[model samples]
Target: MSNQHFLTLQDIAPQDLDALIDRAITLKAAHRAGEASPQFPGSVMAMIFAKSSTRTRVSFEAGMAQMGGHAMFLSPGDTQLGRGEPIEDSARVISSMVDIVMIRTFGHDIVERFAANSSVPVINALTDDFHPCQLLADMQTYREHRGSIRGKTVCWLGDGNNMCHSYINAARQFDFKLHIACPEGFEPRADLLENNSDRVRVFHEAQSAVEGCSLLVTDVWASMGQEEEQARRAAAMAPFQLNATLLAAAEPDALYMHCLPAHRGEEISAELMDSPATIIWDEAENRLHAQKALIEYLLKTA
Candidate 1:
C-alpha cells in the first residue's frame, strides 16, 4: 500500500504485477465457490468519470458491492470540477470521505494531481495515455488460458492509444516481447516505445507483427475523444483490420483479445470476433476479479 496511486502500470514493480495476477486468480476461484471474504464492509469508493465507460463503471461498482463496500459514481455533471473547481480541491474533498477513488479521465496528469492531494488510494481506470486496469484483466485472462506470459510474444494491432500504451508497459512488467502494429501516424508515444525498446517493437504491417505471436490484441481505430477523426483514421487504418486472413498469419494457437466496445467491421471483422480463437468475453469478465484483487491489495486487506 506504499503506492498511493495506480496512474500507470509503470508505477508498479514487476514482482507486484505478478502477485496481483495470482491474487486475481485466487479471488476469482473463491468467488465462484461461494467462499469470498467480504473485506471492506462499510468502506466507500468514489468513481470519478470525465470520460464515459461501460466496463470500467460496471466492474468497479460491481466489485465494490461484491466486497461489501459502496461505490458512488460522479461525473463531470455531478461534481463541482465541471464548474471549474481545481482537480486538487475535488480530490482532497472526495478522498476525505471515501476509502478509495477510481478515475476514468482524459489527461493522465489530472489523476496524478488528484492522487498527490488525496488521502485514499487512487486507481487509474483509464486515461488517454494508459489503461492499466484493462491490462490487469488481459494478463489474468492470458494466464488462465495459457499460463505465464513471460517469454511469450504478444501482437497489438490497431490504434496506438491508451490500451496500446498500457500493453507496452505490460510487456516490460510481464517480461514478454510485444510487437505493435499500427498505421504510420497512429503509433504510440515515442518516449514509451524508446523506454521499453528492449521488449517492444513497432511495425507498419499487421501481418509482420503477428507472425508467431501467442496473443493478438486490438482496439478501435478512433477512441473516445477522436470521434471527429473517424473517417480519416478509417482510411489510414483500413489496411490493419483484424480478420480471419490476418489472424491466420499468427501462430495457430494464438489467442485473440480486444478491450470491448469494439467496432464490428472496423478494428475486427464480425466473424473474427466470434471465432474460436477469441477470448474477449473472458477478458471482459476478468475485469471484475482483477479490480477486486487490486482493491484488496491497495487496502492491505488481502
Candidate 2:
C-alpha cells in the first residue's frame, strides 16, 4: 500500500475492488453483531478536509475507532495546508507522522500531488474529479442487493460531475456499462468518455439513456462550491431529474440511488428518495464498513 493509493477506482485492482466490496459486506454484518476487531491497533490516520463533509468525516473517524485506530481531523483552518504551505511540504510532514492519510478537497490534482510526495498511502476521500470512496460503498450496496454488477447497465441521470466520473471508472473496473444523461455543457471529462467509449454512452434524454438499465444513480446538480450556479444548473438539468417517470424508463426492478444530500424534486424526486424499495440508506451506511475494509487492506498490505 506504500506505493499504492486510492485516488481513483482504477487505483485499486479490479479483482481487489470486488474483494473489498465483499469484505465490506462481511464487516457490516460483523459490526451489527457487536464484534470488535483489533487488526490495526495504535494506527493513526490523518484526515485532511479542504471541503466540508458529513458522511466522509463521520465514516472515516468512526471506522478508525471501530478498527482500534485513531483519526485526527485536519480542516484547512487547522493545518499548514490552509496557510499557503506547498502541498508537497504538507504531505511530507503529515505522512511522516501518520500511518495513512485521507483527503477530501477541491481539485483532484491536490490529492495526486500530496500522494506523490507522501510516504504513506493517500486516499482520496473525495475530489472535484472523482469520489472513489463513495463508489466503494455504492458497489457494496449494489452487491448486497443484486449480486455482482458486472455486465449490468447503470443509468447516471445528472451532471457529469465527480460521482459520474467515478461511475465511469467503476464501469471499467467493475465490468459494467454506464449511460450518462447530462446537459450539453455538463458532460464529464472528455478523456474519460473517449477512453471508455465501449462501456459508456452519453445522452441528453433521460428516458433514452436509462432504457433497459438495472440501476440508476444521480447526485446534486450543483455540487459544493457551485452555490452561485444552483439556479442556472437547476434550469438546465430539469429534464434529468430522477422521478417515477425516469425510473419507469429503466428496468422495472431497477434500483434508484443518490449519493445523498440529494436535492429532492431537483436531481431526484422526494417520493423516490424516501421510498422503502430504494437502498439509499443502506448505501449511506455502507460507507463506514467499506472504508473500514479499505483502511484494513492498506495497512495490512503495507
Candidate 3:
C-alpha cells in the first residue's frame, strides 16, 4: 500500500471521506458488541505533541491500544526535535521506525514539512491552523446522530481558531454549508473564506447565522497559548454565545457539538451545555472510533 498523509480534509476524496465516517460508525458498533476487529495488530504509531492536550492524547493512545497497536508519547522534552533539531531529520529517523505517525503541534508547516520527508503515513492530530482529526470525530458523530451532512447547514460559534478552520474544510469535503459567527478580528483564514465563498458564509451575529441550521458547534474562547488574551476575547465574543435563544431559532432537532474542553458561559451557555439534548459527549467518544478507523485506513492502504 502507498503512503498517504491525512494533513487536511482535502487530502481525502469526498467519497472516501464519507466512507471513513461510515466505517467509524461501524467500528463503534462492533466494539460495543465485543466483536474481534483488529486491523493493526502490533503496529507502532509515534505521537509527537508539541502542544498540550487532553482529548487528542487520550483518544489516539486509547485507539491504538484497542486496535492491538503500540503508541509512543513524545514531547519536546523527550526528543531532539524539541531542542531545535530540524523536523526533516527527525521525520526521516522517526518514520523509519514507526508504522504510522501523529503530530499535534503549533504550526501547519511543521506537519507539511515532516510529511514531505516521511516514508510512512502521517496524521495531523492537531495544528494551529487545522484540527482535522477532531473534525473526523465531529463528522462521525453528526453521521450517527443525523444522516449524511450533504447539503445540510451547520453553524459555528466562537473564535475563528483551529476548529473553525477545520469546519471550513469540512464544508467542502462533506458537501455542506457552513455559517461561521465570529467577531471582526477573529474570522478564519482569508483564502479559505474566499476560496469556498459559495459553501461558507461569515457572520457577526450568532442568531443570524444559526437560524434554521441543522447543527451548531463551538469551542473555547481562548485556546492553548492564548491565555493572556482570554479576558479581552470574552468581552468581544460575549454577544455570540450559544444559548437557549439561539437554539430556539435553529431547527427543532438541531444538535449541538463541541470539540471538548469547552468553556461554559463563554462560547456556549452552561444551560445548553449541561442539557441532556447535547451530543458533545458522543462527539468526544467518537474520537476513539474515528481515529481507529483512520489508522486502519492509512495502514491497510499502505
Candidate 4:
C-alpha cells in the first residue's frame, strides 16, 4: 500500500494492478457470503461529477456505504467551479474535507487538474478520453471467468471510445492481447495507439478482430456529447454490430461484454446480449466491489 492515485489504468503497475483486481474479487465473494466490510468506518468520500452517470454514481455511493463510509455527490451546479471559481481552489478545499475524491467529467485535463492540486487521492471515474473504473470491473470479470487474462484475446467492436482507451492501458500492464475493430475514421486516437507495445493490434474488419478472441466487447454507438453525430456514427458502425454471426467468429467459449446502458440494436443485438455467453450483468455488479477495493486501498494507503 502506498500514497497513490488512480487517474488511469496505466497509473497502476502490473503487480499492484493485479492485486486490486484480486481484492475486488475477494470483496465480491465476501459480499455474496453476507460478510460486512468496515474498512472505512466513519470516513467520508466526495464524488464530483461534471457528467451524468448511472453506473458510476450508484456503484461508488453503494460501495462507500457498504464499507461503513459516507459518500457525497457533487454536481457541477453544486460546486463553485460552475460559478467560474478555479479548479485548483476547489480541489484544495475539497481535499481537506474528504478522505478521497472521485471525479467523472468531460475533460481529461479537469481530472488531472483536480489530482494535481488535491492533497488526498483522486480517481478518474470517467472522462472523454478514458474510463479506468469501467475497465477495472471488466478486467475483474475476465479474470473470474477465464482464471487469468494474460495472453487472452479480448476483441473490441464499435467506436473506440473511453472504454477502449482504458482497455489499451490495462493491456500494457498485463499480457492480455487486444484487437480493436472500428471503421476507418472511428479508430482509437493515433497517439494512444502509438503508446501501445506488442500486446495490441488494430483491425478495420470486425470479423478479423474477433477471429480468435476469447472475449468480445462492444459499447454504444454514440457516447454522451456525441449524440449529434449518432446517425452518421450508426451508419458507419453498422458492420461492427455484435450479433450471432459475428459472435460465431470468436472462440467457441468466448464471453461477451458491454459497459452497459447499451443501445439494443446499435452496438449489439438483443439476442447476443441475452445469451449465456454474455457477462454484462456480472460485470456491472462487479463495479461496486471493484470501487470498494479501490476506495479502501486509496484511503488506507494514501
User: Which candidate has the top score in lDDT?
Assistant: 2
Q: Which segments of model 4 are wrong by more than 4 Å? A: 1-3
Overall lDDT per candidate, in order of appearance: 0.91, 0.92, 0.92, 0.89
Q: Candidate 3 has which clashing residue pairs, if any?
A: 1-302
How many backbone collisions does model 2 have?
0
Q: Determine which window of 10 residues in candidate 3 has minimal summed lDDT.
A: 34-43
Better of 1 and 4 by lDDT: 1
Give the per-residue lDDT of model 3 (tens digit) for 1-302.
24799999989998998999999999999999998775679899999999988988998998898888899999999899979999999999999999999999999999999999899999999988999999999999988888988999999998999999999999999999999999989999999999999999999988889987999998999998999999999999998888899888999999888897888878888998899888899999999999998999999887
Over the stretch 1-302, how does candidate 2's per-residue lDDT look in tens digits? Answer: 25678899998899999989999999999999999886888999999999999999999999999898999999989878889999999999999999999999999999999999999999999999999999999999999999999999999988999999999999999999999999999999999999999999999888899999999999998899999999999999999999999888889889988888887788899999988788999999999999999998888776
Question: What ranking of all candidate models by lDDT puts the best one first?
Answer: 2, 3, 1, 4
Give, for candidate 2, the lowest lDDT window spanning 10 residues. Answer: 1-10
- Tens-digit lDDT track for model 4 on 86-137? 9999998999899989999998999898899998999999999999999889
Q: Write the per-residue lDDT of candidate 1 for residues 263-294, one digit (tens) a residue.
A: 89999999988877578999999999999989
Q: Per-residue lDDT for 204 in model 2?
A: 84
Going through the candidates in the order shown, the clash numbers are: 0, 0, 1, 0
Model 1 spans with C-alpha error above 4 angstroms: 1-3
Question: What are the per-model C-alpha RMSD values against the true structure?
Answer: 1.5, 1.0, 1.2, 1.5
Better of 1 and 3 by lDDT: 3
Stretches of candidate 3 off by over 4 Å are none
